[model samples]
Target: AEECINSKIHEIKTLEQVIGKLITRYNVLEENKLKSLVNIYEKMKPKDAARTLNELEMPTLLAVVKHMKDSRTAPIMAEMDSIKAKALTVELVTRNRLPFATAGSGEGDG
Candidate 1:
């Protein structure tokens, strides 16, 4: 009877260890899935997308702007009020380092 009880106790301990490992693996997978979903959602959100574009380094922003269709680009730029649009345009033109153009140059001059 004593030997039987020892075997049952050992089985219970082994079962508990298995359950703990499964729980650990489940938690890791859940965390990874949540992180991936959050990243995807951030990329897909229009506001976040605009902010990301606004924050990109000048060279990268220029490259992205060059490839974007004007139809798509105009609305995003227009979403900001006039002042912000002008500021961002100036920033893009100056590589984020200088003020907007002075009055001398006509719109078609360049």
Candidate 2:
């Protein structure tokens, strides 16, 4: 029983390390994909980019905006549909705001 337990524990540890490496690899791949997309957007003219961007769903659009440089993003936003641009900006700001707001609230709990 003791040896079996030890073996199981070792197996669990090995599985955890494998899971950690997989997560790291996944994150790197996602970052690279985001960078590649940002490059594609940056290379397009603002109006063309806006038209392409308009077809993307909101979450995908927000993810692109998050990774994109502000200088490049600004021109695209200017060319985008005003209503869509405003909504995207609001969603981006909300994503950033949640963490800070939650952290600030937690500090006073002590």
Candidate 1 structure quality by residue, lDDT tens digits, 1-110: 99999999999999999999999999999767655643453444445556666665655555555445555566666654556567668766666343444434756644
Tell me the lDDT of model 1 at 16: 100
Model 2 residue-pair collision total: 0
List where candidate 2 sits over 4 angstroms from the true fold. Answer: 98-110
Predicted candidate 2 versus true structure: per-residue lDDT over 1-110, tens digit per residue: 99999999999999999999999999999989999998999999999999999889999999898888899999999999999999998888788785547556555653
Give lDDT for model 2.
0.91
Identify the candidate with maximal lDDT: 2
Model 2: residue 43 alpha-carbon error in angstroms = 1.0
* Candidate of highest TM-score: 2
**Ten-residue region with minimum lDDT total, candidate 1:** 37-46
Candidate 2 collision pairs: none
For each of the candidates, the C-alpha root-mean-square deviation to the true structure, in angstroms, is 16.2, 4.1
